[model samples]
Target: MNTSPSVPGAGRRTDGSSVRIGALVPLTRPGWVEAGRHLLAGLELAVRDVNDAGGITGRPLELVVRDTAADPRRAAAAVDELAGLGVAALAGEYHSVVARAAAARADALGLPFLCSSAVLDALTEQPTGRVARLAPAQSHGWRIYADFLLGAGHRRIAVAAEPSVYWAAGARILRDHLAPRGGGVTELDMRSLDPGAVCDELADKRATALLLLVGHPEPAVSVVKAVRRDRRLAGIMIGAPAGQPEFAEWAALLGGDGTAVPFLRYLPERLGPLGARVGAALRERLAEAPSFVAYEGYDTVAVLAEVLRSHGPDRARIAGSWPQVAVEGTRGPIRFSRTPGIGVWQWAWPPVQVVDRDPAEPARFRVLHTG
Candidate 1:
C-alpha cells in the first residue's frame, strides 16, 4: 500500500513544518473517559502554552491523538501506527494495562513514551530507555495507602477485587506492605460475590476496612451502597486505593455513600506556583476542577516540550534525555530516575495523598493523610 505524502510521518516534510507527538487516550466507553478528558485537557493546554510562547525550534508542536479505549491490543496497534506516522514521542494513557502495552510497543519501536498515568509497577517485562512514567508506581502509592490503613487503626482489611492484573498487583502490594506491620488483607473476589455477598463476607470476617480493588460504578458502587446500608458494616471503613473516588462520577453516582471513602491522589497538599497557574488554566479548559490525571498530562507535555526544545525531535535523543530532565512542573520539580522495582524511568513520585470527599460537603475534598 502506498503511504500518503501528506501524513506527518512521510519523508516529504523536509521543511520541518511541525514536530508531532502521539497521544494515546481512552475517550470512549469501557474506558474511564472522564479521566481521559481531563488528561487531554492538560496535554492540550500545555501544547497551546508551548506554541503561544514559541513551538520547539519555531516549528509548531503537534499532537496526533488516538483512542486506546482501555484495550491493550488496540493500544499496541496505535503505538505501531503512531510510530509509523513519525511521532517524535508518545504520551497519555490512564489505564495501566493499556499503558503497559503501549509502553512495550514504544520501547520496541524506539519511541519515547512519557506515560501520564497508570500505576502498575511492572510496566514492562524488560527495562528499556525509551519509556518513562510520571505516575507513582503501584507499590509506592499502595504502600502509602496501606500505611494510612494502619495509621487509622484498621489492621484487618478486605479488598473487593476483580480479576485484573492491575487489581491483583495492587492487592499484592498492599499485602506485602501490611503483613510485616501486623495488617492482614482479605481478598473477596468480586467475580463470585454480589453486593450482598460482599457485605456478608465483610460482616463474617469482621474486617475493619474494606478496600475497593474493583472498578467504579459497577460492583464498587453497589458494594459501597450495600455496606453503607447494612447495620452490621456501618462501623466499617471503606477505601479506594485505586482512585475510583477521584473523579466526579463517583460522587455523582454514589452521592453521600461515596463520601469519606479515602482514595489515593497524586497531588501535593498545596500546588506550587506553576501547578496553581496550570490548574487554573486546566479548570478553564475543562470547565470544572481537574483531576490529578490532568496535571499529569500537563507535566508530560512540559517535560517533552523542554526535551524537544533542547534535544530536537529525534526519538533516540528524547529517550536519552530522560535522565537529565529537570522541569518545574505543576506539582513540583519534575525529574526522572530509576526507582527500585519500577522498570521505566520514573518521576520518583508526585505528592501522594489519601483524600476523600467530605460528607459534610460532598463537593469539597478533605485530606486524610499525606506522604
Candidate 2:
C-alpha cells in the first residue's frame, strides 16, 4: 500500500492502486451529527460503487474522512491536511460556515472541491475556479419558497429566523422576492423570544403563514410545536425551508404535530435508476432511510469521478473543467451556472420539493408541492 508520509489519515488500497478524495463532515455537532452520518453513508456507498465499476481510471477511489464538527477553523485545517495527504480532489460538507472556510483552503491549495450540501448564498460569491456546489444555493431555495407561498395566496407572511449566515441569506431572498408583489415579511428574531411568544405575536398580526429560517432541528421543531398550540392560529401555514429531510428527528419529536408542517426537501419519492441503485445500497448498509443529504453525497463523488475520468486527477485541470461539466446526477442532470451575486460554478437546478410529514406515520412524509 502506498501512503503519504506527511498525512497520517491517508488511506490506500491493498493493491496500491487508488485515488484519495477528502471528505469533510461534522460528526460531533450537537444537532448535526445525524445529518453528518447520513451524508457519510452516501459518500461511502458511492465510493464502493465507483470502485466496483472499475474505479476512477482503473484506480480505486479511497476517502480520507475528516470530522469538521461544523467549525470553520477545523474545517480549514482539514482541507490543508487533505491536500498534504495528496488527495486528488475534495468532497462532502453540510454546514455552510464550515464549507466557506474549507472552500477557501481548497482553492488556495489548488484542489477541486465539490461542496455537497452547504447553501450559504455567499459561498460561491467570489469566483474561485476550484469550487463548485452540488446543492442549490440558499437564495435559489428561498426563491422557490417565496413562489410557493405566493402561489398559495399567502400575502401577509411572518418570518422567524435564526441569527446565522445560513438563515439570514434565505430570509433576505424571501424578503426581496415578496416585496415587489406588495407582500412583505414581518421578521422575528428567534433568539430573543420564547417559541410560544413568537407564535402569539404572529397570531396577533393575523399572518397567513410563518416562514422559519432556523439552522438547527431543535429550534425548528420547537417553533412548530408552539404554533400548533394556538387553535386560533390553525389557519396559519408553517413552513421551514432549511430544516427539512435532515431534521428527520422532528417527526418523532412532534408526533402528530409533525404532519402538515411544510419543509423543503431535495429527494423525491421516486428515485431514478441511478438513485434507486444507491438508495437500495444505503438502506441495506446503513439500515436507515436515505435522506437528501445522502443523495448529495453520492452525486458529489460521481461528479468528482467524472472529473478524474476526463481530466486524469490533475487538480487544476479538474477545477478548470467544471464550467463544461454536464453529468446526469442522481437527482437529475447536474449543470453549473455562473451568475452574478450567486456563487461561482453553482448547480443551477437541484430538484426540490415541499413536503409535509405524514400524519398517520410521522416517520414518513407526503410531497405537497414540487418545482
Candidate 3:
C-alpha cells in the first residue's frame, strides 16, 4: 500500500520518517494523459530507485502528486497544497502556463522547485524565480527545429501553433530563424481543433509545408485533417516534432504518411548503458512504451537524483550542485548553466517522420530531410 510521508511545515504526521517530494502534473485531462503519465511514472520509478538505494540521506523519499489539470489557477492551487504539505521541493510541470503559476507560488513560499515539461521561455524568467527547469525551453526547441527545417532544404514554410503563450514564443524564435535567410515564412495561428477553418488557411496561404506548436494530439490531427481537406495539399508536407503522440496519430490519420519531427528519438540500444536501462524499465512498467518525453522524464529524474544525492536535497545546496552534475541522458548530454538562465541545452533537435499507413514502429518514423 502507498503512504504519505512527513515533511516540515506541511502538516505531516509526527513520524518524521520520509522526505516528501511534490510533483505538480496534469493528470485529469484525456488529451494530456499520456504525457502526464509518462512523466509521473518516471518520477515514481526514481522514488522507488532511491528507496532501493538506501534512500536520500538515509531517509526514504515519498512523492506527493498534485493534479494541475493544465490550468494555471488550478496549478497555483496545487502548489499551495503541496507547500502546505511541507514538501521539501516540487518538480515536473509539463505545461508552461501552469508552470509559471506554480513558479510564482513557489517563489512566494521560497520553495525550490524543478520543472521538466514547461518549454515556454517566460516560465524561466520569473522575477523572483524559485524554479529550475530540467527541460529545454521553447526558444531552444524553436531554434533547433528551425535549424532543422533550414538544413532540410525547406526555405519557404508555413507555421501554426496552439494559441498559447509557449507556441507564440516558439513562433517568434522561428521567425528569427527564417527572417535572416529570407522572408519566406508564412504564419497561421489556430486555437481551435476545427479542421475546416485551418485547412482553408493552409490552402489560402499556398503553404508548401506547415510547422505546428500544439502538443495535444487532437489539434495536431486537426491540422492534418485541415491539410487533407484540400486535395491540392496532398503533396504539401506537415511537420510538428515537438508534439508527439499527436504526430503519430496525425500521421496515421493521414493514411500513415504525414510528416512529423520529434524533439527526441533514439533507440535505447544505440544510446549506451544508462539509456538502455532506462528505456527497458519504462517499457515494462508503462501501459504504453516510453516516448521521447517519457525517456526525457526518466532522464530528468535520474539527473535530479544525482544532483540531490551529490548535493543533498536542500534547495540551496541542490541549486549549487547543478553546475557540477552533468549526465548523458536519453536526450544526450545535459547540464545546468546560469549564464543563459534556461538551465542547459542538452537534448538534440527532435527527429522527423513521414506518416505511413502502417505507421511503422511507434519508435520508428520516416526521417524527414534535415540538416
Candidate 4:
C-alpha cells in the first residue's frame, strides 16, 4: 500500500500502490506556513496511523499534497492537477478564500472534498454534496466572537480590515450579529492608512474594542504595537477574530503584546480521551503543543478513513457519503449535514472558544469564553 512519503507536498507514487488523498495546504510564503506545517503534520501522522492499522481495504493511504500558498487560482489549479492524478478524494486548506476556490473547482469536477479548516459560511455558490467542512462556519464562530465582544462590556467596535472577501465577510458577520444588540461596527480601511492612523481613528471614534481583520506580521503586528504604545488608546482592547495570534510567529514577533488578544479557536476547554491521545501524539510530532487546526487536520483524515472503509474511494461514493460519516474525531463526534445558511455539508459546529494567551504566562492559552 502507501509508504509514508518523506517530504510532505511532494509528488505521490505513480506505481498504483497506494490509495491517494489529495491535500491542499499553504506551505510557502503568504500562506501562513506555520499553520500549514501543523496541518500537514496532523495529516501525515493520521495517514501513518491509518496505514499502520491496515490501510483502507488493504491499500496504503497516501496523501498527495499540494501547496495552495494562500492563492485561490493556485488552489483551483492544484485541484485540477490532483483530479487528473487520480486522487480518490481531497482534503485540507487553511485560508477561507483559497478553500472556496478549491471547493468550487472540486464540486464542479465531482470530486469529494472534506475541508479541514477553512470556515467561510459560503463554501460554494449553491448547495452541493461533493464538499463538506469540519471547521465551524465563519458566521457561526465570528458571531460568537461578536457576542464575546459585547459580553466583555465593549459595544462600540472598530475593525481594522484589509481588502479581502474573507475579511469583508467577517466584518458583515460581526456587524449583523452586533447591531441588533445595540452594538455597531466601524470599519477602517487598512489600504490607505498606516498603524499610527489606525490608532488615531480608534481614539477619535472612542471605540473600546478594535478587531483586527488584517493580515498577520506586517500591518497587524504594527497596529498592535502602535496601539499598545499609545497612551490615547490605553484602555482599548485589541482583538483578532481571524486568529493571527494562534501561531508562534505572532508571539515571537509581538511577545507580550500579542498576549491577551482574543481570537476564535475551535476547541473545547478540555480534550477528551481521543483528543488527549491525539494531542499528545501531535505534540510529540510537532515538538510543540498543537493548535486546534492540527486537530481539525487529524479529524479530517479520521472521517475520510471511515468513509473510504464503508464506501470505496469512488468519487461519487465518497461525495455521497458525507451524511453517513460517523467517526470519533479528536475534538468530538464528527458528522456532516446541510446547515441552514451554509451551501455545503457542514459539521453543525465543533467546539468554539474565544481564547487568548495568558499575559501572565505567554506560553499558555486561557479560554475567555465558550460558544
Candidate 5:
C-alpha cells in the first residue's frame, strides 16, 4: 500500500481546493514492474499536461499513486486506500485480474473507474455504471488479429497459448473466428511444454503460421526464438497477439529472429498529433519510446480529465458521462459501446495494429496491418 506524493504542480489551488484521481499501477510485480513504470510515466505526463491546460475547471488535477503488484487482493486493498484518500476518480491499471478486483471494489464504493489497459471481457461484462474500459476487450482484439491472419492467406495456423485468463480469452476468440472460416487451429499449452518441443510439434503439423497467445514477453520471446532455430520451421510466420510495443524488449532479445514477427499494438508507426506529442515527451523523459501501456495510461487520464471538466468532480456524474463521451483520443476517437455480448461501456474501436519488429533496428517497429 505504498503511495507516491502528488506531482509537484498538481493539486495546487489558489482557493486551497483540488481534485484527486487514483492511479493503480503494478510497481513491484516481478514480470509487470517495468510495464507499470511505463504506464505511470504516461499518466504523470498527462497530469502535467492537464494542469498546464487549466485542469478540471481551474482546479489543480492531482493523481494519487498506488501499486497493485499483480495481486487481486493487493489491488482491492489499493482501491480501498485510494478511496480513503478522497480521490474523485480512478484510472490506470495494467493487469486484467487486478483490474477486475479493483473494479468490484470501486463499484462497491461508488467510485468512477476508468480502466486503462486490462483487456479481459469480464471486466466490463457486468453492468457497473462505475466502471468503463479504455482498451478493447481481449475477444474483440483477438478476432481482429485472426481476421488479419486469414486475410494474409494463412489457413493452417498453430496457436501456442498460455493458461492465463488473458491468453485463454484471446485463444478462444481466435478459435471461434477460424472455425467459421473453414480454417482450423492446433492449440498448444505453452506453460507445460518445452519451447523446442512445441516448435517440433508445429512443424509436424505443417502449420503455415504460429499464433502465440502467450501473455508475457519472456515466454513469447522464448517460443519465437525456438521456432526460428528449427530449420524445419523456417519461413513459418510466428505471430504473437500480446507481444508488441508492450514487450518491445523482446525484439532486442530476438536479434535477427525478430524480423516480421507480427504482434498486435495500439500505437502505430506514425502516431496522431496528440500521440506524437506524448511520444516525443515520453522519449525525452524516459530516454525511450513509450509502449502501448503508456498510451493507455495517457488516454485514461485524458478521458477522466474531460469527464471531470464537464461533470465537476462528481463521481456519479463522471460515470454517467462516459456513455456520452466522444472525445478524439490519441489512438482514435474514444467512445464506449453499449452493444450486447461486449463488455459494458467498453471502447468499440481502440485503433489496433499488427506490427513487426524491425530486425535492422530492434528498437523500431513498422506497422504491417492496421484495424
Candidate 6:
C-alpha cells in the first residue's frame, strides 16, 4: 500500500497539514468485495504514482475508503462518514442505486464526489456541484445497445431478467432509443415465469433478438438457460451490458447457443496503466479475474485523478474543471457538455459473443466482436 505525506492548507499550505481524502467501496459481500478490490488496487496505484511524482501542488493525496456492499442504505451512511471526515474528494463502485444515495449525502454536505463507476443516469444530476460521474451514463449504455440492435435489423426484441430498478430504467431507455427507429419492445418478466415456462414463451416469441437487462448473476443466468432449452430460438442473438464471466458457465450448463455481452474495447490497452495494474493485482489476490464492476471502479478513479491534477483539490474547482479534462477512458473519452448528458464522452459499446471460456483467465473470456 502506497502512502502519501500530509497535505498542507490553503492554495499552498506551507504549514504541512495533510488533506483527508475519503472513498467508498463495497468490502463486505464476496461479489462486491472481489470487484472492490480491483478498484481499490487501481486507486492505490494512482495514489502511489501521484505521490511518487510529487502530488498535486506538492501536497500528497490521501484516501479513506468504506465498504458500501452495493446497498443504498449502507452507501448513504458511507458517504455521510466520508463527508464528516472532511475529505478532499471521493470516488468508488459501479452500482447507480448506491451512487444515488451517496449523491444525496454529498449534496447535503457540499462535497465534490468523483463517481468511480455507478452508471445510473440520475446520479449525474446534482442540483449543486456535489455529484459528478466518470463514465458514460447507464441510460446511455442502454440506448446505445438498443440502437445497435435496431441497426442489426432486430426490430422486435424480448427483455428478460431479474426485476430490479436499474433494469426498469434501462428498459425505458432502450424503448426511447428504439422508438425513433420504429422498433418494437416486449418484456418477458423472469420473476413471473418458471424456468420451463420461460423457455416456452421465449421460443414462441416473434422477436428477432434478446436483451438481458438483469442485475444479479442468478436470474440472468436462469433466463439464458430458459432461452436456450428450445432449439427453435437458435437464431435469436442474446446480449447483456452487465456481462459476467460466470455467464459462460451458465450458458454451458444450459447448452445455449446464443450468449453475448456488450463491452467497450479499450485502445492502446497500456494507456490505462492504472486499470491494468488494478486488474492484475485483483487476479493475484482473488485468484480470479476482475469483473466489469471492477473496471468501472478503476475508470472512476482515473477520471477523478485527472480532474484533481488540473482543477486542484477544491470541490468546486473539481466540478468546474470537468469540461476541461479530456479523459480517454476504458470505453472512450468522457467529456460532459452544456447539454447535461449530450456529449462526446458518451460511449456506444458493441455486443460481443462469448465464443469460448478460458479457465486460465476466467475474466479474460474471448469476445466474438472486435474492431
lDDT of 1 by residue, 103-147 (tens): 999998989999999989889999888899999998889899899
TM-score of 4: 0.96
Better of 3 and 4 by TM-score: 4
Residues forming the 10-long window of minimal summed lDDT in candidate 1: 1-10
| Tens digits of per-residue lDDT for model 5, 37-72 | 889888988888888777778788888998888888
The estimated TM-scores of all candidates read 0.95, 0.92, 0.82, 0.96, 0.93, 0.76
Clashing residue pairs for model 6: 7-17, 7-18, 9-13, 335-345
Give me the runs in candidate 2 sitting further than 4 Å from their true place: 1-15
Question: What is residue 162's positional error in candidate 6, in angstroms?
Answer: 3.6
Give the candidate number with the greatest lDDT: 4
State in Å the error of residue 307, model 2. Answer: 1.3
Candidate lDDT (C-alpha), each: 0.89, 0.80, 0.63, 0.90, 0.81, 0.60
Clashing pairs in 4: 1-60, 2-60
lDDT of 2: 0.80
lDDT of 6 by residue, 1-371 (tens): 12223332223322244445677776666334545666676566556555665566566666777777778887787777777777767777657677778777777777777766666666644455556665556665556556567666888887775666777888888877887889977887877876677667666777777777665456666666666666777677667755443333443444433334443322223335544666676456545555545455556656776777787677777766765767765544666554455322233331222233433543345544333
Ranking by lDDT: 4, 1, 5, 2, 3, 6
The clash number for model 2 is 1
Instruction: Write the residue-wise lDDT of candidate 2 on 44-101 in tens digits.
Output: 8778777767777667788889888888998898888889989888899999988998
Better of 1 and 2 by TM-score: 1
Stretches of model 6 off by over 4 angstroms after superposition: 1-17, 30-33, 124-126, 245-296, 306-312, 326-335, 341-371
Query: 270-309 in candidate 3: lDDT tens per residue?
Result: 4567767777787787854565556656666667767666
